[model samples]
Target: MAELANCPKCNALFMRGPATVCKDCVKREEEEFQTVYAFVRQRQNRTATVEDIVRGTGVEEHKIREFVRSKRLHPAQFPSLSYGCEKCGADIREGRLCSNCTEEIQNGIQQQDQLNDIQERNKKKDLGNATYYSMKRDKR
Candidate 1:
């Protein structure tokens, strides 16, 4: 069921559905998309960067980035287009993180797993020692 909520863009109360924004905001965004699309569809502007598109169409940089993120703008069509990595703010064409950050995170996880394994082995050894001592005490 749809719930009454304020639109993130305009803060106007409306029934929340698949679209997060209200109808007015949605309409405005569609207009912006058309303006940006038209500007980029031109032959000379086909290879333009996000900055160029923003400058030409007067659209916000974030809005253009959102389009790229949503796959509305194909990176292959515009080689210069990229989005900032969530971790390091480096430019990346796809995924959440750059390759360097991804490798670092994977290395950290591997180190953590090694430490956990060592701890588990130590815990089992300690438990064995405690059991042996308890058995000896009971025998005495």
Candidate 2:
């Protein structure tokens, strides 16, 4: 038996499947999907951020993510496809780097570590110098 569901848009009954839409609703959805797909498929738009898609199609980010999750939209098919970072919420396509920002963050940590090491060494040197002065004064 074919599973039946009411289209959320028109409340018409239809065979259940990937979309919660009737035949008529599906047609309309397909048209809208095509418009969104075409815009995202463009080379320049391929790497568009979440904001870009929302602005371009008036579609929600969650819906776009759903399309990607269901394989309705394949990122590999679109080379410029990308997503936001899990850690920092930055726009990223591959790995975790928004690139420039990642490098900047790493450099900052390295510099801070180096400064701390220098401070620690200076503190040790000061202790040694104070001990030496006290011993010489005691002998005088």
Candidate 3:
């Protein structure tokens, strides 16, 4: 027989399989379902999509969507919920950036461009100086 592994939710011992969650955790999850449901039911929060709930509630997107599809969370409560835009592989629930990381990326790119331009200008100046020296040497 195979040995047991700890459950991810509650760390209870269970027969290991594809599932990381144990039965007791499953029961606890069921008991806590209403807590998730009630939070989504608020007027200001209602109509939030799965992505919105993930952002607002700090729940995993996949988990929240599964709950929504399972009728654990009411779809009627969140009619306005929509998936967040994929910005540089981040879950941007409210804005384009999950953080200011994209701006940092852009700033890095701009810095690189400035450095490249400076190098090109230096290379041209060197070439011009070399040409001036060669012409003077030729006249001598």
Candidate 4:
């Protein structure tokens, strides 16, 4: 069930698969990854930051960040490698949002749940009261 899609990198039409970009882009990315990896694997470059890697390997910062995000580059091996949190722009090694943002989101969801519960209870109470008044009127 392969579908035709434009390559994100080159805007050329190709069959979509597990890889987001077309075959040519994927090959280019692989070469870039190899270059970056080779540079990082050097003894003196183990602690290199993403900027340093980009400068040394001539690869784009976003490409290296993408590698880190995809787990192709492990943060444990490269301590200076990190990405900004989507919510707070805090430095993080894994996931989209930082812990603080995640906790805040959880608390917001809890508050919304409580509010929904209160509204549901109020609606049920109103329905019960209406039914009681209708029954009383019928009895009279």
Candidate 2 Cα outliers beyond 4 Å, as residue runs: 3-5, 15-20, 79-140
In order, candidate lDDTs are 0.89, 0.73, 0.66, 0.92
TM-score of each: 0.88, 0.46, 0.40, 0.83
lDDT (10s digit) by residue, model 3, range 51-128: 666666665776665565455554455665433334565444344454667678799999999999999999999988
Instruction: Name the weakest run of 10 consecutive residues (lDDT summed) in model 4.
Output: 131-140
Which rank order by lDDT, best down to worst? 4, 1, 2, 3
79 Cα displacement, candidate 4 (Å): 1.1
Sorting all predicted structures by TM-score, with the top scorer first, yields 1, 4, 2, 3
lDDT of 2 by residue, 1-140 (tens): 55888878798889977766788976876676677799888888987765788898887776665465455777787554456665676655565557777888899999999999999999999988884334445554
Model 1: per-residue Cα lDDT over 1-140, one tens digit each = 89999998889999998879899998998899899888888999988998999899999999988888888887888877888889998888888899999999999999999999999999999988884333435554
Q: Report the alpha-carbon TM-score of model 2 versus the true structure.
A: 0.46
Give, for candidate 1, the lowest lDDT window spanning 10 residues.
131-140
Q: Judging by TM-score against the true structure, name the best candidate.
A: 1
